[model samples]
Target: MTTWNLNGMKHHLFFCNGGSCTKKGAEEVVEAMRDEIKLQEADVRIHTTRTRCQGRCEDACVITVYPEGVWYKEVTPEIGRRIVREHLVGGSPVEEHISYTYEDELAARPDTKEGQSKTKRKEAQTK
Candidate 1:
């Protein structure tokens, strides 16, 4: 049973860096997000991840915000920065750039806090 605990962190931001997305400005989005996160240094709590393929190639330059599962597409460097500041940091999902979404995850499962798999977590615990 893959039970995802639902009462953990606040937000999880996953940016897709697959080849298609990269050609579509995913790299710039990544850089912008990094810079913006450094600038805010907030206490609201958020996790940022660089994912492989999110399977939304039409929206190649895509970022998926977890808990919310709010997918923003056609992201430019500028939009990425704004999303960090406004949504990830300020607790508001930027609506203007939203493409696809599945909010059910937000209510049902808590994200794994990024950067690790369940096996990795178990290994760390064992060590």
Candidate 2:
């Protein structure tokens, strides 16, 4: 099978509606993210996917960011906007709102200074 490339983008935000989350405005969050992405013309590819039972029923609504692998439960439209603006757009993980964790190594965006420095350091050492 051929793997689909996400084009080496920074973050991937997944919103899980999965019954419980739908009642908590998960759809609204998705729409908001779509609108925000268009409004800002952001370079980051905000992949929105629906999953079953994010396993945080108490938290209900959930959104997971990859390669950072940070999960945000009980997400709202406001929170969604913040995620896009702060974490997705800013290139930093939002600690206060983080939920679950992912083991996948998230690639850093070359646009950010820290990411740039890391890349430079890696390249220099390789030579």
Candidate number achieving the greatest lDDT relative to the actual structure: 1
Candidate 2: lDDT over CA atoms? 0.68
Model 2: colliding residue pairs: 71-99
| Cα lDDT, model 2, residue 89 | 80
Going through the candidates in the order shown, the clash numbers are 0, 1
lDDT of 1 by residue, 5-37 (tens): 534447777899998899998888888887887
Candidate lDDT scores, in order, read: 0.73, 0.68
RMSDs, each prediction? 13.9, 9.4
| Tens-digit lDDT string for candidate 2 (1-127) | 1216667556666678788888888789888876786676674465556677777676667888877677776677887788788888886665556544542234333443334334565787799
Q: Candidate 1: which stretches are off by over 4 Å?
A: 1-9, 104-127
Candidate 2 TM-score over all chains jointly: 0.68
Q: After superposing candidate 2, which stretches have Cα over 4 Å from the reference? A: 1-5, 102-127
